[model samples]
Target: MTKTQARKLPGYIFLSLTALASVFPLYFMVVSATNTSRDVLNSRLLPGTALFENFSKLVAQQDVASAMWYSSLNAVGTTVLALIVCSIAGYGFEVFHSRGKDRLMAFLLLAMMIPFAATMIPLFQMFADFGLVNSSVAVILPAVATPFLVLLFRQSARSFPHEIVEAARLDGLGELSIFFRIFLPTMRSTLAAAAVITFMTAWNNFLWPKVILVNNSYQTMPMLISNLRAGYVTDYGVLMLAVLLASLPTMVLFLVLQRAFAEGITGAIK
Candidate 1:
């Protein structure tokens, strides 16, 4: 092989190994979901006929469906609100360009560095005061304007063409119209990536939901999964099934939108 081709071969092998490493756990989870608890304890890697039994156990659990629904609602709600707010904030921060806004952005970055544990009590108290505790809104409100998403949007907005904005302004398009009709469509990929990240974070969130949601009826999938594992005789097969079901939406979303998500990120960085 040519020297360049030889150099690329190692990178390709490394990538393949990394991909396998990532997929291995998911494969194991799928296999375990199809096995009995005994089979899971024995680390069985092959699919078995116990899938229906495990699924039946999962469905028979009173809160499983409700928890899944609540989790889905929280994930979808948080993603939509976060994308709208953060994207707008990001676009404004980059395009408006004021010293005060720059300082605000720096403060936001500092806020991001603060551990969530530090603010957990205060956040919970605020939600309690607003009578939002035990609601999906409680899980979503604190995440709607995430600093990380704001930063992502700001970076993506850097690639937004200034000439287009100027032309839109000259054509008498209002600021909101320009943003929605012009900028949004152009930055679809970046938004898709942000949406995926936000949805995953919301779906997998445990600590905040566990703390805020006092009612078992309103618990999320992660919280339910935790409760399941903590039971006296934990059923590994059932737990695996719960995990597989919990993971389905994000997996499907990534499969459907991954191309746009990847391109958006690449474009933003470029």
Candidate 2:
């Protein structure tokens, strides 16, 4: 090999190993979905012919379709609302050029350090008082204005061109019109990244939803998976199948938006 090729070999090897490590669990989960509980517990690495049987068990045990519907509703609601609210906050923070905004932004960042567990009880109580428990609103409302998403949009907005906002204002374009028409189009990648993040988080959220959505009819995919493991003698095959199904949407979304997600995360405008 050439000298340059030799020098890069170790780095390539390390990256390959890391990639394998990342993919192994997914590989195992897929394999386990096709096998019986015994084979899964035995750590069998090969795919089996029991896929249909496991799927049947999953269907028999849970309302897979209902769970998916509720999950989709919650995820879509959270993503849409979070994008709107956080993007506006971010745009105002970066574009308005105000004095107190920086201090307020810092305070929002401080709120991120506060663990969700610390506020979960109060949130539950508030929602209960509002008679929103066991509803989709209870699941989606809490996540609509997270500090992390605001920060992300704020950082991305730093690269936005303020000259455009000024020019639009000179033309008498309303603030909402500018945001919907100009800002959103210019920041498509960032929005995609934010949507993917928010959707995935809402889809996978377990604890809050578990605590709030008491009715079985409002079950989400994660809650379905949790229920699958709740029995004393868990059906590993069915559980794996449910997990695989639950994970598919987020996986597909990430795969589709991965490039934009990377760009957005790095605060790159393009």
**Which pairs of residues collide in candidate 2?**
none
> Residue by residue across 26-89, what tens digits does model 1's lDDT show?
9999999999999999999999999999989888874787888899999999999999999999
170-208 per-residue lDDT for model 2 (tens digits): 999999999889888888888988999899999999999
RMSD in angstroms, all models? 1.9, 1.4
TM-score between model 2 and native: 0.97
| lDDT score, candidate 2, position 191 | 91
Question: How much is 269 displaced in model 1, in angstroms?
Answer: 2.3
Model 1 misplaced stretches (Cα beyond 4 Å): 1-14
- In TM-score terms, candidate 1 sits at 0.93
